[model samples]
Target: MKKFLVLGILFALPITAYLFFASGKNNFARLPVLTEKVKDIDQFKTNTDSVISFRDKISVVAFFGSELDDIKGNTFNLDQKILEKYYDFNDFQFVLVLPEEAETRTQQFVTEFNKISESSKWKIAYASPQKVQEVFDSFQSPHKLDENSFTPYVFIIDKDLQLRGRDDDEDDGKLYGYDSSNVAELSNKMNDDVKVILAEYRLALKRNNREK
Candidate 1:
């Protein structure tokens, strides 16, 4: 009886540990690819001519429309939350795209954000409304723009520039899922999801190096 009980305890411990880690594995969902890549970084006009691309790092992309609305503050807050947690990481970035008309506003917003920290892993830029609309249509996701406004839900674009969302499978972008209305929940989910993709990319990189 003593030997049987010891064996049972050992088996239960490993199973319990496995269950704990497995439950945390689905913190982020693999959404369908939105775009293979951002071909024309030039189209994403910035105050400086510094070239930016999704070729080498994971990016979090979002449409900010006009900066005069409350959504701008909400978006900035969310970005701040994300930066606070991920500022030290060099492999991730955030790009907030605004309408070309918001060029001046975009500059001011970037300046203000940069003031919070001498360094900013996030960037703000503008693009023609037509180009912006093209990206939204490409996603074919209604959540790209709020039904009632031009503000958009945030999106994760992998190192390969594929758009992602928190959906188990592609739902024609209808994976119009999750709520960012709550800042705390939004921050936790977004941070964890980003970590998931980054982890997967790093693992792939390791495998490729080993193969070579």
Candidate 2:
């Protein structure tokens, strides 16, 4: 009887473990795409004069407009709560879109930001106010930019240039962007969503390698 019980327990353990992990994988398989084919950043000019596109990269995008000082707190909240955590991940970046007139201010903002954290993965792009409006409008989200062409919220763009967010959020039924000023939102909701997307890509890479 004891030997039979031991054999049964041993067999059940692997099955139990498999079920547990399988359930977890299913739960986080992929983040739902809220918007498809968001406008790429190729039209904007970067400090390095290099083309920045949304192709094949996970990006956290924000619009600071021309007033960098105004959004300093919001930027810091996003940096500490989100960017600092995922900046080192492969093909993951923070894209801050600013108006063409804010070049000097943007440089100052970058210098100040670098004093506290690494800004290598933070790509700053400049565009005309008209172009900025065009790109923001491409999101098709319910939220709108403020008078300064700025918003406290930041959006998550997947590798395929699609927006990813919750369709059944408790507060906003359809959450399109996270408020950078809200640390709790960033720490709780945004962090989990980012993990889901990153895991989705990692799993894809593994499967592709296996097939090869």
Candidate 3:
């Protein structure tokens, strides 16, 4: 019975991980490629050329569905420790896309974030339902949703702009299907991605610094 229990635990772990990350393995996805003409959180109108294109840099593009309650005190699921140490030191960034209802509220959140951290390390952007549709349409999903994206969902993009891993959200980007089941496990994986991104950035920057 002990041996059986141990084997079961091992098997369960891999299955869960596979369910979470396997979707991003496919190169051709329904999501839209990053584009210009998007507005940053500062209400600045800039093209994609002005921002850090993740072509060679590690990037994270998470489409939040706009939960007003999360903003009581600057709510964000990604750990700040991981963000400050790894993301800030490394060349990491995030795109906090806006939902339909939270346009104004999202802007306020951006302001609050800047008030908290004045550094220009990370960035936030807003995308209308139409723009978001450009992404979801390719996947044959409904691009015209009046509501926001469901909770507990995140998308992980790599340097090559390939969707390498995802926590939840179906093939159609409907919602998250948990691999870890527990909140702590999910949170840890999110942190792991940030740490790896920082490590990658350090190597690149170091190489550049040595060249100089």
Candidate 4:
């Protein structure tokens, strides 16, 4: 009887340990912090005549072109899906960084967005063409911008103004990636990633308070 009991305990021990470590690994790899800090964007101005600074808030930044066809699909995704899902999260902001040429249609842009979401959290902003290029360059964007073409990728910026992406470090910092080809899938995936990031920030705050 004693020999049988010892064998049972040995077998269960390894199984329990494996399960514990597997669960820990999954939670650890769930989200990643942007490895690089974004360039200071204080010089960029918002439509409300104020400097754009997301010091303590998570911001979604996207480059918007002036062409109607280029802008329509993205606008629908933001208004119908993203905004509707996170309307109550006051700490979040969506900054639509338009090209210098879009400056002429700023009012029209504001009116259209406001119809979908009346929150003051939405901002339409602009910067010089040179400054805009500098900002996008830091992000390591995949697409090239020609005289009349640009990719419509949305960047996720955290509370500290750092852009979030998959870190190349081999350990466990892989971030969730999405399919940009499908607007619905992209929106849903982005929404989940944002919530995970926010939850992580809250956990860090709790830990710091306990340490103090």
Clashing residue pairs in all predictions, respectively, total 1, 0, 3, 0
In angstroms, give how far residue 19 of model 4 lies from its true place.
Answer: 15
- Give the number of colliding residue pairs in candidate 4: 0
Error of 1 at 157 (Å): 0.7
106-203: candidate 4 lDDT, tens digit per residue: 67656776676653566766677677777767666454444432446677778776777555423334432333445765555566566666677778
Q: Which stretches of candidate 3 lie over 4 Å from their true place?
A: 1-52, 70-74, 79-81, 114-121, 136-146, 166-183, 200-212
Model 2 quality (TM-score):
0.87
Better of 1 and 3 by TM-score: 1
Model 2 alpha-carbon drift over 4 Å, by segment: 1-27
Cα-based TM-score, every candidate: 0.75, 0.87, 0.50, 0.72
The lDDT of each candidate is: 0.62, 0.85, 0.46, 0.64
Residue-level lDDT of model 3, residues 1-212, one tens digit each, is 99999999999999988876853332223233333222223332222336434455555544555675553322343434234454544445665555555666655565666665532454554456565544433223222333564333444455555443333334434322212223453455545554544555567669999999
The count of backbone overlaps in candidate 1 is 1
lDDT by residue for model 2 (102-185), tens: 887777788888988786568988888888888889889988887678988899998888999888788898999999999999
User: Where does model 1 exceed 4 Å of error?
Assistant: 1-23, 27-42, 117-119, 144-149, 169-180
> Candidate 1: lDDT over CA atoms?
0.62
Q: Give residue 198's lDDT in candidate 1 (0 to 100).
A: 72
